[model samples]
Each structure stands twice: as structure tokens, then as C-alpha cells.
Target: MSLLTVRNLNVNFAQRQQPIEALLDINFSIEPGERLAIVGESGAGKSLLGAAITQLLPKPGYIASGSVTLRGKELTQLSPKQWQEVRGQRIAMIFQDLMMTLNPVLSIGAQMVEAIRSHTRIGYKDARKMAIEKLAQVRIASPSQRFEQYPHELSGGMRQRVIIAIVLLLRPELIIADEPTTALDVTIQAEILQLLKEVCESHGVALIFISHDFGVVARISERTLVMYAGKIVEQGATLEIINDPQHPYTQGLLNALPQMALPGQRLNQITGNMPSPSERPSGCAFHPRCRYATERCSQEIPSFINTDVSIAACILLEELVSHEEEPDV
Candidate 1:
């Protein structure tokens, strides 16, 4: 059985006039120890999807029609108390901002001990020991001294590592990490990604890694879901999506990636900006910005059509295939 399954998950918020759908019919499943990455530009609902899965949607946001299931148990039906039991113990989330997740006044030891006591019946001393071990697991030097320091005393990377340590300490079956390395430097980002991969592989943890950086997602994720304007436009193995993107939005995103070029060579960029959430286009949310969009694309939403290793929502798939069939340009 899949460890986590989210089907038709819709997160809506009440606006001045009507309810704005932040996420529209999101669907995916993760088997045990599987790593799935959700990649898209900002406001593409990647973070919102993570929040929805963990039942931590922001104020005025609620799940409208859908189900989030873990081990075949429906999470949407869980009461606040039941959700408390499930949140940190069975499912943990690593927020993008470590400072928001950590308490400024509490020492690392105190915070971790509290977390352990909340989930288990261990004594404070035992919990402290476990906390120290977890800090060490994340490769924090002088775990004992670091545990006694407050959040402000550590570096950004160190604070992030502490958050990760706490999340993995419980060994939750499913972890939702929302751009956990966004604030760190490139070297630290690589290290953190490696650590996350190792922890999930060794503990059978299903990970939903949410980020906008395709390069980071491509490095660690086996499967990639390309989201746009609150919907998934393309999904496939990481390599396939990077090498043979079917959707115009996906192609544009790839084209914008920084490439190794000769001196003075200008980098390509995706033209135009993403539409505001309230002003999303009618038929296809991306139609306004899609280079290959046609009348059909602007009038009718395309169904997700399977293409062997990938699935894409694009009316121009046939045209794309036919063009590829012709001789090299």
C-alpha cells in the first residue's frame, strides 16, 4: 500500500467576493521510502500543497473536496485532537523558515525534549540524550554545547540542521519538506539534501520535497511533478521531465535555467509573469503565457494524457510529437 495518497485535494480561501481555489484537484501518491519532488515557480501552490497535506493550511484556507490518506486512513476527517496526535509523531513537516519553526527563547535541548515527551513517555533525561544524538546525526559539531545554545546563537545552516534533526528524530513515516534549504548557501544546500536522502532511505520515510529549483529536485527526486497556477502540468521521472518536457510551461522553465555559456553569452529567460491567483485564466491556467497555446487551449482544459513515462496536460502534444518526428532543424 502507498504510504501517502492525496486525491483531488482542493484548498480554497474566502476572498472579498468569492472563494479562491488555491489548489485545484491535486493528486499524487508516495510509496514507502519514495522521494517525490514538486517543482514550480512561486505562487504555483507547491507550498500550499505541502501545508494541505500536513493539515496546516493558513488561516481562511480549508480543504473543500478531496482526501489525504496515510496508510489507508483518511486525514481530512481527523479532529483537531486527532490531528495533534498525527502531526509531529506520524507526519512531520520541515518548514522553509527554520526561525518560524524554532522558538527563540528556548534552548535546543528544551525544545527537543518537549517534542520527545509529547510523543513518547520517556523521562526528561532520556529525551535530552536522544536529542543530543539527533543533533550529532545532522553532523552538528559539539552537539552537547550546541544543545545548550539558543536559536539565535547558531548559523542559518545550523538552525536548519536542528529543525531537520527534530523532524527525523521521531522517524515519521511521511515527511513534507517545503524548500528546507532555500536560505542556506549552495554547499550547505547540497549537504542538507544528501542528509535528507540518507535519512529517508534508511528509515523508510516517504518524502514530498517542495521547491522551485529544478536542479535541486532533479538531483534527489526519482519522480518530479511540475506544478503551475495551482495545477500539475507535467509529471514523470526526473530525467524524462528535464530531457523531454511536453508542456510549454515546462519547456519555458527549463529554458530559463542558467546554462554554462561562453563569456558574454546572455542567458535565456521565460517571458512575462505568472498570473495572479484571483485572475487565473479560464480554460488552461497557463494559456495566457504558453507559447504554443491555441484557441482550444484558451477555451478547454486539457486532460492529463499519458505518454509512456510521463503525463502532460497540453493540447499541443500531438503537434509536439509530429515536430519531433521531422528531421533535425
Candidate 2:
């Protein structure tokens, strides 16, 4: 059975002048010990999806449609008090910004101890011990020393490691890590990715890794889902999506990668910026920037079509493939 299942989920924010559809018809699932990556540009709502599943969407934003289930239990129907029990215990989130995960005013020890006490009936000393052990597990030197230090005291990588340690403290069933390595250097990023992979495997914990870096996604996840303007435009096995992206948006993202560009040439870039939720296009949200877009693409929304390779939402998908398959005249 899937550890986490999100079905037809839609999210909206009540803006000052209008209602913004932050996420639309998002659907996916994660099995125990499975690693899935959500890749998209800045406004694609990856982080919002993570927050929604954990029942922590920022204010004025809410699940407008669909359901979220964890371990067969419906999460969307849970009370806030019930969610308090579920949030860190069943699903923990390691935000992109490590600072957001830690309390600046409190020492690491205090925050970790409080988190443990809140979820489990553990004594303060025992919680501190667990915290130090997790700190060591994340490869932080001087665990006890680091535990007593504040967030600002550690380097960016170290701080992120501390947050990972805190998440580990809960021994969660699933973890939503939102670009946890983005702020770190390349060496540190690789180390952090390996650490996450090891920890998840050791615990048999499922992972939802939200990232814009396709390379990182390919390295860490078995499956990948591509989102654009709050919609999942394509999803498939990680390697398949990397080797053969179907949707134009997905192709654009792959082409924009530095490795995909020729040497001494300008890097490929997706022409336009992602549209805002309020300013989203009428039909296919990606139509404005999609090179293969047709009049039909601009007039009608595309539904997810199963092509045996990947599930893609693109109006011109069949035509695009046919053109590539047709014999030259």
C-alpha cells in the first residue's frame, strides 16, 4: 500500500483583490521507502504541495479540492489537534531554508527536546540523548557541543544537517525535504544527498524531495513529477523523464540544463517567466512559452494522457510524436 496518496488536490489563496489558484489537480503517491522528486521553476508550487500534505499551508491558502491519505487514514479530514499529532511524527518537513526549521532564539538541544516531548512521552535527558545521536548520524562532529549551540553558530551546511537531525528525531514515516541542499556548496550538496538517501533507507521512510535541479532529482529519486503553473505536466520514472521528457515544458527544463548545452555556447533558457497564479493562462498554463503550442493548446486544457512511457498533460503530445515518427518524404 502507498504510504502517502494525494488525489486531485487543488489549493487556492485568497489574495487581496482575487483568489489565486496556487495548485491545481495535483495527484501522486509514494510507497514506503520510495523517493519521488517534484521538479519545477520558482512559481510552480512545489513547496506549497509539500506544506499542504503536512497540513501547514500558509494563511489564506487552503485545499480547495481533493483528498490526502497517509497509511490509509484520510488526512484531509483530520482535526487540527489530530494533525498536531501527525505532523512531525508521521510526516516531517525539512524546509529549503534551514533557518526556518530551527529556532534562532533557542539552543538546538532545547528545540529538539521540546519536539520529542511534544510527540512522545520521553524525559528531557532521553530526548537530548536521542537528539545527539541523530546529530551524529547526520555526520555532524561534536554532537553534544553542536546541540548546545544556536542556529547562527553553525555553517549553512551544518545548520541544515541539524535540521535533518531534528527530523530524524521523530523517526517519521515520510519526509518532505524541500530543496534541502540548495544553499550549500556542490561538495556539501552531494554529501547531504547521500546522507538523506542513507537515512531514508535505514528507516524505510518514504521521501518527497522537491527540487528544481533535475540533476539532483535524477541522482536521488527513483521517480519524478514535473509541475508547471501549479499543474503536474508530466510524471514518470526518473531516468525515463531525464532521457525522454514528453511535454514541452519538461523538454524546456531538460534543455536548460548546463550539461545539455554545447561547449562555449550560451546556455539554453526557457523564454518566459512562470505565470503567477492570478495571471495564469486560460487553457494550458504553459502554452505561452510552449514552442509546440497550437490554437487548440491555447483554447483547451489538456488532460493527463497515459502514453505507456509517461503520463503527460499536453494537447500536442500525439502530434509531436507522430511528426518525429513519420518517414521523411
Candidate 3:
């Protein structure tokens, strides 16, 4: 059975009584022990998807439509009290900001123990033991000593380790990690990514990784979804999307990778910025920035169509296939 399912999900912001659709008909699913990455430029709603799933949408913004289901349970219809049961127990979120996950006044042990005891009926002593175990599982040296230290006392990497340890305390079934390694140094970033993958695999936890870095996604996730302006432009196996991107946006993202260029050469970059939610275009969100865009693309939104490898939202799949005889662009 699927671990999680999202169908026709929509999010909107009420701006001066006008509804600005932030996320439009989003849909996807993840299987048990699968790692799926959601990649896109900032403001493309990568983080919003995570927030929506956890019922953490910011003020003035709400889920406009659709459902979020986990193991056949409709999360959208659940009461706040019921959602409280699901959040941080069945499904946990590791936020981008470590500070947000840790309380400033609380020591790492205190914060972790609170998280554990909130969901489970364990005493403080048992919860502390569980926290130390998770810390060790994430490869933290001297887990007991680290537990007594405060969040500010640790380095960026150590702080992240504590954050991961806290989430894994209950061994949740699913984890939503939104740019969890973005703030760390390159070496630390790689280590954390690997640690997350290893820990999740050992525990059979499904992961939804939100990131804009294709390299990170390629290394840690088997499947990837490319988002643009709150919509999934393409989704498939990571290798398929990396080696053979179907949508123009996905193609552009892969092409813009630094590895795609020669040594010392200027890196490729996509032209134009992702449109703001208030300033979104009428039809296809990426049409204004796409080189392959035609008049039809600017006037009519594309439907998600199944290619041989990926399901892509693009009107020019036929044209792209016909021109497949030529070299890849």
C-alpha cells in the first residue's frame, strides 16, 4: 500500500479578499521505504507542499481544495486534535531551520524528551535514553554528552544531528524533510544527507525530501518531482529525470547543472525568475521562460501526460519527440 497520497491539492492565499492560488491541483504518492525529492527554485512551493501535508500553512493561507491521505486516512478531514496525534508521531517534519525545531531555552535532551513524551506515554528517563540511542544511530559521537548541551553550544552540523535525532525518537512512519541540509557546510551537508538516507532505510521510513539542488536529490532519492510555480512539471525515477528530462523546465534545470559545463566555463542558468503567486501568468506558469514555448503554450495550460519514462505537464511532448531525432538540447 502507498505510504502517503496527495490528490488535487490546492492552496490559496487571501490577499485583500482575493484568492491567489499558490498551489494548483498538486498530486503524488510515496511508497513505504521510498525517498522522493521535490525540486524547484525558491517560491515554487516546494516548502508549501510540506507545510500543507502537515497542516502548518501560514496565516491568511489555507488548503483551498483536495485531500492528503496517509495509509488510507484522510488527513484533510481530521480534526485539530486528531491532527495533533498524527503530527510528529506517525509523520514528522524536519524543518529547514534547526532553530525552529529546537527551543532556545531547552537543552537538546529536554527538547528531544519533550517531543518523545508528547506523543508517547514514556517517562522522562526512558525518553532521554531513546533520544541518546537515536543520536548514536545518526553517528553522533558521545551522544549522552551532546544531549546535555544546548542547541547554541553545538556547531551547525552537530545542531542538525540533534534535530534529526529528535525526529527519529519516535521512529515515525514518514518524514518530511524540507531543505534539511541547506544551512550546513559542503562536507557536513554530504554527511547529513547520507545519514538521513541510511537512518530512514534502516527504519523503513518513507521520506519526502524538499530541495532545489539536483545533485543532492540525485544522490539520496530514487524518485524526483520537479515543481514550478506550485505545480509539478515532471515526476519519475531520479535517473530518468536526470538522464532524460521530458518537460522543457526539467530539461532546463538539468542543463543548468554545473557538471553539465566544462571546467572553468561559466555555468548555465535558466532565464527569467519564477513568477510570484500574485503575478502568476494565465496559462502554463513556465511558458514565459521556456525557449520551446509557442502561442498555444502561453494561452492554454498543459495537462499531465505520461511519457515513456516520466509523467510530464507539457503541451509540446509530441513536438519534442518528433525533434528527438536531433541532438538533445
What do the candidate models score in CA lDDT, each in turn? 0.88, 0.90, 0.90
Segments of candidate 2 deviating more than 4 angstroms: 15-18, 320-329
Tens-place lDDT per residue, model 2, 75-191, is 988999999889888899888878877889999889989988988898988888899998998999999999999999999989988888888888899999999999999999998
TM-score of 3: 0.95
Summarize candidate 3's per-residue lDDT along 1-329 as a digit string, tens digits.
79999999999998887899999999999999999999999999999999999999998889999999999999988899998889888899988898877888889888888888888799988888889998898899999999899888988899988888888887789999999999988899999999999988988999999998998899899999999999999999999989888999988888888899999998889999999998999788999999988998888888887889999989898556657768767
Give one digit per residue, the lDDT tens place, for model 1 in 52-114. Answer: 888888989999999999999999999999998898888999988888999999999999999
RMSD, every candidate, angstroms: 3.0, 2.6, 3.2
Reference-based TM-score, model 1? 0.94
Clash pairs of candidate 3?
none
Of candidate 3, the 10-residue stretch with the lowest lDDT total is 318-327
Off by over 4 Å in 3: 319-329
Per-model TM values vs. the true structure: 0.94, 0.93, 0.95
**Candidate 1, 297: how far from true, in Å?**
1.2
Task: Give the best candidate by TM-score.
Answer: 3
Q: In model 3, what is the error at residue 18, expressed in angstroms?
A: 2.2
Better of 1 and 3 by TM-score: 3
Q: Give the TM-score ranking, best first.
A: 3, 1, 2
